[model samples]
Target chain A: MKRPFILIVAALTLLATAVPALAQDATPTPVPPICLNYVGQPDDIRTSYYMGEGLGYYASGEFSRAINSFTCVIFEIDANYAPAYMARALVLTQRSDYERALEDYTRAIQLNGTDLSGYNNRGIVYTLQREYDEALADFNQALELDSRSVVARNNRAVVYALQGEYELAIADLQQAIETTGIDAVLADLLDPEREEGTPPIRDYDLIEAQPYALLGIIYSAFALDNYQAYLRLTGSNGDFRIQSAAGALESRFTFDLRLDDGTWLLVADFAPEG
Target chain B: MRRTGLIGTRFASSLPLIILIFLIGVFTAAAQESPEPVATPDPSGVTVESCRELTERTAGALSIRTDAVAPFFIGLGDAAFADEDYTPAIEAYSCAILADPTYAPAFMNRGYAFFAQRADPLALADFNRAVELDPALALAYNYRGMLYTVQGNFGLALGDFTVALTLNPDDASAYNNRAVVHAAEGNYDLAMFDIDSALLIDPEYPAVYATRSAIYTALALIDAEAYRSRAGEAARYPNGSPIEVMGGLESAAETGSFATWLAFLTRR
Candidate 1:
């Protein structure tokens, strides 16, 4: 899905650390090579050559130069190269040229319907443009492609948050966090053939905390909306407080409201999935 | 004479106390015999205070007692971590660290546990201590670099990532991480190079694919803009036709002069 910017921010706030002793591992790791080699395809060779040049200029911070190289690949090299269109779209997005970016994304999607990122990124652009319905549709399409995609769920949550649908947002965020937890648990439970080659399992709490906080934020926003609606109906103000207590596997988000009678009443209790 | 002989035989046969004392003496002697040594033979010449240690050291040759020590707790932590029982793993790692603060692996592992828990501050502190104790620990630097990158401290992140690469050039993850720094700086070329390096080291690594895809996409847009300047339409592509730009290329190739200029511009 369009890279989950929130998760990126959250991960930055909460991150894992490790980088040594991959030497002992036997697994064939995938590296980010130039990928110029193509078997039995002379045409693909030309494509990679241009792609490599485009990538090089892009990496050098020459945005305009990079765009030209990629465009040449798209127009002069091969019009069917979905990756070239996708690449150009990314640069356009970076430059805030959302119109062309959206077009490129759509073309990329048209060329390769199986790639979910195209839909997800287009959905992001739609959301940015305040086209909530279209954004939701694209996110839905992505989820249909992969039901278990956490990135799609999170992006959809963003759309929901924008629409003041806090409940759905909370649900999506909680699901993303829970999925991560489940993944970590499952990874740990499985036995690898060799200990040295296996990637170390991460701690669940590290991954769960920020999403949990985000869930709480959504709950708070929802509570505020309810309180505002109540105030509008009663023509009076009320005191409200949000309290949270986290357990080993779950956390409780409670909103307590004090009426004119001086008695505290429970308004909302959201126990998001861990 | 026969009656006197019978009386003597009866007196000899009626010595019950003497017979009982003789039996007790035999039983006592058996009880007092030295018991066989309980201590098992140790070919490794290592003294084991607990059965846990004995069994672990002897590979199940001996198991008679349960032991809780630094190494034992470390093993427990490692097991819990493998099971994704992060809470128990952290607890076990804590115990290991408590037992032996100087143990670099314990600190490193505990730091990892903290990281998994999303306790960044705790994780960072543990990582700091781990690196302090063991300067050669490349993983600590790599992790710290990840943390720094997330925190948006690209400078520190770059330093840590570079250090990790210096220590182990084959660390594909470090190369990928360094690429993230380059990407953040808008140096897409270097970013792609680093990612490519990572791919070369570990061709199966999945994360680099995403990064590579992103780089390719970003470059396309950036270069598309450059296409405008050459076409003399600084605002946009001519009639929104990207194909029009290729018109001059065929003629440029024949003349060599225009082709050289186009190549320089494209390469630039």
Candidate 2:
């Protein structure tokens, strides 16, 4: 199963129309990939709500409903809206409809290739089909486009390790940890290169700020190697914590961890305790 | 306001649905300690009031500082899974569930978190609630089916797999997962047939090949009477587990990541 991450760029595309900016580069390129919110007056703003509703549905784990909602937005407003297709494609992927997911990813790319998510996401589908060569190609392009993208680097490292290229995998992991020390997996990945004076990776941040540590510590306690703590904390003690981003500027996550016999148990009922 | 489960039997049940909570019976007398006020949205819930009340107070007890508890727990769960911190993520999700019994997504999400953590029982409970809260949710059934198959519960596995399949015919996971149960039951023909079915829907799926390889093994192992060594060899080594030679399935499955999450649901 593909591990789900905090979907930012893709969420933006799905939530907002995400049109490209109309600025010209000194080198005579037409327009950059950076776009503004939906335009053309008050009527278009409704599209944004439809998109947000779709994202919320997605967040709530209702993929099919989210697809329908997004499809409705597409049909009701701009049929060419890429987010609608992208959102639907995500549902298709959950359904294991790779060809269709790939098709949508392709269209998403064609609609806006500069945003590295399209290539990176398509690459994931290719990897699922064991199309490593193709998966590698996509990861390569993704890394090329955004060299700082820790997710792409970490994923590429996984591909490398599966191919038995331990060294390459280690290098990629090293770089990923260096670039984003806040990555849970990177921290979980015990590397030999840490002794080589590697710089500590940066923390995960929100768009509003440089990055608030990504609160990644809540995620990396698995390999900590304890069993009793895991079993002790595995179940809900007849209660849960409820929380949200609430559009807050700070980055804090409600987190608890336990180690249960070769298993890492974590509980995160989001609330802004802090 | 209402316990999501049965309202009659539970002493300390904390569900958004009242009926299911009280059905558990033994936890009923201790309802007063549950932390939330139990509202008898329906007339039959007198016993659940004290129990549900305790659950509610505890559920809403997150301090302002603890306000990030649920989402933090959920994010931590996913992140922990990504980092292979399965144990910690499991704890995180469980806490999230406790914090809000009404949080259906927490149960579903935590169920997946537990699966990755290899904690089958916990995962089963989460998937159970996820499906219970949303009957048309195909992902929950598909997951529960896989868990059942792993335990060799073919009857249960088949039921869930069938339910999932009915929900989404094109879902390769539902097909591949059911195929394993078939293979385990010595029905190589039916098992291999499912693999073919999955591939038909998803030509590029590498997991199907891994699954098919297992079917090849089952065929070669059990169909010894029908095929001589040569025939057995043909059936089993039809390119030797396909993807192992191609070096694709594991890596491909890995790439799915968050990029490929689809849930099959009815129009509702």
Candidate 3:
């Protein structure tokens, strides 16, 4: 028994010594290399790093810094990068530098033909410049690309309004509102990955200005006079405020009148307390 | 045999330590195989020039010119206002003004932010500065008129509204506002005419209908049965108009500022 036990102890010691040696000799599994379309293409790390830096700066409201990072990728890393151009163009739009913004947008479009945002954003610049026909054409092209594009459709509505085609404008707004819901286009302007700290203001898209303006125009044109007609058309008493010229009594009342258009006009009176 | 037993006991004592060493080797190898965690960029005090430096340090960095740093902050303010974060919006607009003192929109928007925060004195100062900087800004006149109206200075309110109208006749909301002033002065006929004009401009205006109803109600109180009958007759569109419009008037306090007015005027 004693001899066998001695043999077992010797075996245990040998096994313990060999286990570590075996681990040392074992070859590690090789990591696969990141795939690239072509062998001579720029290394993915530098390109991705700058792109990430650009986006990070943008989120921090350092637009000029963001532009610099994007510029580095375009000039140094890859001249053909469409996203760099597009991002730069968006920042330029906020600056109201329409001409250069248009140029950058055009370049981005040239780089990537299928992207709808390039056309849509360029059309917004056109709208801001009051280049209505050009704006319409771009909007139409974007629509053809994707009929359900809320951004393009809302933009088209603004164009119609600018042209003084109220009916068509209202129709477009109704459709856009129904399909995408109110303030849906506002979503595109927001960055989802933005941190929860104080965020910077984005430029107002004129598309957001259409519906209310149209509503005001519509109510103005109808001129509903009868209280019932006013309620039938707009289901609320139009109460307006007025401070009494005689006493400190402020009163709220609905103002209505009969018009030649065979419509009843209703307005709210808001009277302030003295 | 005694020596053999001693060796066995020593081997058993060292077993746990040997196993611990083997586990440590496996863990170290795994740690080596994993990629390093990326460091997040420091966002503190990040500015336009700092960004330029980041690119300049890199190989092949181009010298690019950027413009309208002021407007960028104004946009930031506008965005904060949209999110209903009035404090940050005020700060952003202030930053915009600092970047470009001539930027009238910054003053105008800052005025709006002040109004939203109930800082009336500050709002008045900014609005005044906005009009001084750009007299052609119709929105400044519009909001200033609203402030005058709230303060019971109807004369000033009327003057400001008239100026806003003179600047932009297409402002349907201004027409609606002027009609309110007319009604307040007990000039019902003039009020009726202004309301008609507002309706002519924007038939879809939800508040005008309510304003129109108030006019008739006030008219009825004056002549009682006669105006009431007229109001009732107007309500009858032969067999009665189809469809009911439902909503409320946008408070002047809410739509008083140009920036807030634009937001409210465009709300669906």
Candidate 4:
């Protein structure tokens, strides 16, 4: 009887310990983040309405009135409204007022550092001003916020190419192509559903095409340099022939040498076989 | 033998208590395995009027009226619109368009008045004409986006809003409206990001606050539904009733941000 009682006591203790351990090991399910903040206010309505009016003015191509509307929102309604600055900057940019546009972009960035467009557009303006360093910095910052951003990478690549850093430019462009998969972008552009109506081409198609065009230009430059160097070194009056061919997935370019006697020789082919 | 008998009796007497302890431990473990749903605050006050107000406030303006008579008619139209007189505003804008057939603002303003009167097809035609006359006019795109939102064409609405933002990045209202659309689509993360962006642009935007509250309420209800589904028949509030999880349907019936959100959802 005593032995049986001891056994029962041990069994109960074991079960108690094991149950809690099992509970502790169980994983909790994830839930979406919830916000608990103020709602139902009249002032927000009026302010948003005023902003819509300003946008309406902007859409109607009434630059001065649009500017005034946005300015009113900034000065009279809410000074902190970052969108007004951004809107005003856009108009300024359209009117070739880069100086004020820069100021507004800077202010918008200050208000909202996470907005990728602010950085990207500011970088573009800097590029337009020939401020390559500023442009590069802004593009880099934008890329840091979103590493897979093809636009930022492409913009950075443009700056690099402008600075004659072809290698870095090529690397950035290649990475962008990899991240976005140019084929997929092209597929979207060529999707049969788009043929139902005369829909405008998407920006992705244009953006995806840039790297290929840039790469071709860069490669052409390299090939041209080699041809020039060959001419200088060998003092040969041979005609250099360049031929381009397009494939289903890629474009191929080959450089060749032809003597006046009609003898052809392959010099170099930069593009990989598709 | 006598000592062993006493020990056995004592152990037997405590056996029931030991079993009760074991049962308590097991039940506690089982409870811990399923987390209780966090109580969500009621999102009760946001209204459809706020959204309507936002839309109504997007009145068109004629900034560069080249024609002499066009400017006067535009001014008249603007005054009529300000006085909540859609018919006269539409007429004045139409006269301005007649005076200067190429004036894009007249078309845009007329579209605004048409929208106010719920003449969607007419408003859409006017907006399309305005855009055709002046592709650079950001306000036309913004107004068209609002019309699209009302028409339940979210894709077109989003595209137009994007164009408006691209044309004028400072349009806080565009961000707010886009956020509203995202919330309606159950894209809570995107909704939160847009709402935050709107706040960054204008910290005191009341409509954004209302939208945020609606999003929160939606999230809470989603969480509650998830909990109830996971717990099945065993799920219950502190009261004897099961979790009362009213989706966007019930909330939409109430006038406010949720109602606006429901409109978007149902239309989609």
Candidate 5:
């Protein structure tokens, strides 16, 4: 009786595994729609032409006409086109129509969850509305989709900074700089034997500079906060000076505070170290 | 004994409050005036020059070639365009295109002529053909981007500007155009970044300053609206006048000193 029971149990396990294998063989996995490179064009030639016309209107700064053209692309041709929704949402965002923009962005995301820009852009809308938790969640999801995305990291840092999570903000920004290769380019720029007429900057380098600028602002705020605390604790009348070095960089910042005739004077200076 | 004990307890609790009040008074007495720092100079205001005017001045350098006939016609077109004669410019550019159908610059220049005359469709066709003829022609992309921008096709415009920049990283006009598109899309952070890059490339570029002023004005208005919405009926002014608020915002926009403006608002 025990041997018969063992044989039945083994047969049942094999049937369960074989059934799933057969089902897997019968059904094919569906591919997700690509969103990042979505240029808002449709397969139909007429829709594409209208999309081009709408883009022309948008480029011309006739936002109302542009919006109308995009709407035509949506209503007249393909309602399921994610790019149209994304484009219309962009125009709505520019107009500060946050509600409609949110709706459009949400719709675009629904149509294509694979597009990281959808999440990043929607996160921006949330950030603008002061919906920090929602923004963070969107950013986190975006990061989960693409770990190396500098835009998501930078935007998430901004949200974190808004929420007063300074350390987290700093970490994210540092990661952004790393991912953007700003440090490597800066190192190359600092080389003394480099060829002449070679530009020390690129368009993307400007983007990388944002992190450095943000870091400076954060450090400045820290200096001010510390100064206030020092004043509260010591009640000092003498000039108070704090000097700090930027992380992993040769730049130094000095914050000076002086009291003169019942007035406080503060000055911050950035001096690069040799 | 109970009354004495209660008095001691009350005194102990009030001691920290007394100290806190004393500290606040001392700080107030010592810092009667706000902090003083060097002020940033006011930047130039927005320029009245149109986008086309700006682009024409900064348009990509005319493509030089060894072909004599096309170059001659191109020279004629350049002269006419420079003189603001759109008809002759268009005819000359057409002749250049006829002389060399594959010359991307001819198409781009003719497109410019058509654009000058407000013949957008013709200009777009020429620009499109120019891009098709030479995918690497940065000027063609720039002109087409400008046309697309005019036609309200920002996605294509952005694509064109980005392509132009990738082809020629030193093109300050491309940076400025991309900045304008970004600003229009409500991506102020990206807009500001592009503007800074443009200024770095060409500090004397008037269009960049204009773009910066526009961005600052937009930001000031947004901040003002937020302040008003939050303050509601309890809004206060520095001098009890609404004009002061506008004045402060204008000053902030002109000077590009948002921090100063925010401080002014908080003080009110």
Candidate 6:
């Protein structure tokens, strides 16, 4: 009976101590999920290991090794894995085996209609081979299924630009910028990185890209203000535009200064890269 | 011994009431906690400008707490107008007025740009509607008076200029414009008085000097010396000024430059 009384007293004291804190934390918090970038673990470990090794090789600039690893995963480890086949085909594309890459991409798309990566990869291949109309149609459908789809938007813009529809390309990019707030969509893809299994394209980060957009916009706006000031004095539209445009990560730079009496003068020399 | 033990048991039994009180306090505390703050959407919806954006119209986009999306369009239009790109500016301003039944500034701006573009009829229509929306719009009355004078409607011009003058006593443009109408009707005294009022507000204006010069020139033509030379020259100055010395009609009918010029000016 005494033990029952002591237990009752202790329970009452604990409840009194905890009630106010629980009451203070009554509002529910909104937790957004972390978006994943790479493929996750498959049911089979050998195929997963092969896929992981391939990705690691690709990330480390060993395109040949990545291609070899992915092909082994596709042929020997798991014949039914769509991603394994897709990864091998990407290696073929890096090696400029476009015909074989197109076949694998088509097969992947046949198996899964929702995998935007397959469509985007094929569309890029179509763009490189100059099958513009087909590429545009595929990009348009990709955008329709996923309006937040920046890859489809950017690829379509590239096709439009190659077709001499500069304004249309700019318009599409503008919409993509507004939709996803990704400034890299507007960045020029000057260099095509190639290796055994790596795609001959920059691995532009397409994750929640608000920071990239904000930084790009701020940089461009600053350049605009500076270029406009220069234009006020020089009145050369082409020169001002060239000075303000974003260059490749690696590019040579030259500066030519002309004197009042038509003499070539050198004022400054600097490279154009960030 | 039994009585004291019964009393202690009664005290122990009151513990249920204390536990009930504690739970009620916890429940009350939970009830007193404030709800989480929600993220409210912007009341002014996203305004899609002409360049570097999506669609032109904000039709499907809802601006919270407003049925009039016209103001946002009008704001976009105003920014374009400041850039002096009048074509897109006019399109935006027109859409703004179409969205709102009572946007007077848009009417004023659209009228001004149309006038600059030499679309005079449209300018007149907008100015008229702006004044109708608010009769006390002094700038509208002044512009309407100028348009009427350009079309040779002197009586209407005078009335509008008078109304503008009544609203803004310091409006020198109204006085100058009214003086033009007076000079047309040959009321030189009233015309000179209006010119004087305009000059008081804006001295050293070259156009005012030009107007006064024209009036003096007309007055000097009736002097005795001018009458003799003009009549001797044998040309009948229209408005019934008679010329006594001229060649026969057949002799003077070679090119007919003077008569043609006179006829065109008369039509105007």
> Which regions in candidate 2 have their CA more than 4 angstroms from the true location?
A1-274, B1-73, B222-268
Model 2 Cα shift for residue A72 (angstroms): 20
Where does model 3 sit among the CAPRI classes?
A: incorrect
Model 5 chain B worst lDDT window (10 residues): B58-67
Worst 10 residues of 6 chain B by lDDT: B58-67
lDDT of 6 at B47: 36
lDDT of 1 by residue, B15-105 (tens): 4632453344334323432423223222113232333342233211111012334444555455456557677566655654555566555
Query: Each prediction's interface RMSD?
Result: 26.3, 13.7, 19.4, 17.7, 17.4, 26.1
Which candidate has the top score in TM-score? 5
Candidate 6: lDDT of A6?
A: 100
Local accuracy of candidate 5 as per-residue lDDT tens digits, A214-235: 6665665566566656556766
Off-target runs (Cα >4 Å) in candidate 5 are A1-43, A192-205, A231-274, B1-268
Cα lDDT tens digits for candidate 3, A42-126: 4443455455445445645666666665676677667777766776676666667677778887987788667666777788778
Q: Please report the candidate that would top DockQ against the real structure.
A: 2
Residue A127 in candidate 5, Cα distance off native in Å: 0.8
Whose TM-score is higher: candidate 3's or candidate 5's?
Answer: 5
Q: Is the docking of candidate 4 incorrect, acceptable, medium or high quality?
A: incorrect
What ranking of all candidate models by lDDT puts the best one first?
5, 4, 1, 3, 6, 2
Task: Identify the runs in model 6 with alpha carbons over 4 angstroms from their true place.
Answer: A1-251, A255-274, B1-89, B95-100, B204-206, B222-226, B229-268
Residue B78 error, candidate 3, Å: 2.4
RMSD of each: 35.4, 27.3, 43.5, 31.6, 33.9, 37.3
Give Cα distance to truth, residue B17, candidate 5, Å: 99
Residues B65-89, model 3: lDDT tens digits: 2222444455445545656777766
Candidate 6: global Cα-lDDT? Answer: 0.55
Clashing pairs in 6: A91-A197
Top-lDDT structure, candidate number: 5
**lDDT digits (tens) for residues B1-268 of candidate 5:** 6534544565466457435533543343234343222221111111223322322231211101112244445554554565576775666556555555666667788888888787897888777667666666777778888888888888777777777877788889988998898779776656777788899999999999999889877776666667678878577643334456667667879888775445454433
lDDT of each: 0.60, 0.53, 0.58, 0.61, 0.62, 0.55
Query: Per-residue CA lDDT of candidate 4, range A115-182, in tens?
Result: 66678777777777778899889988988878987778877877777677879988988998888787
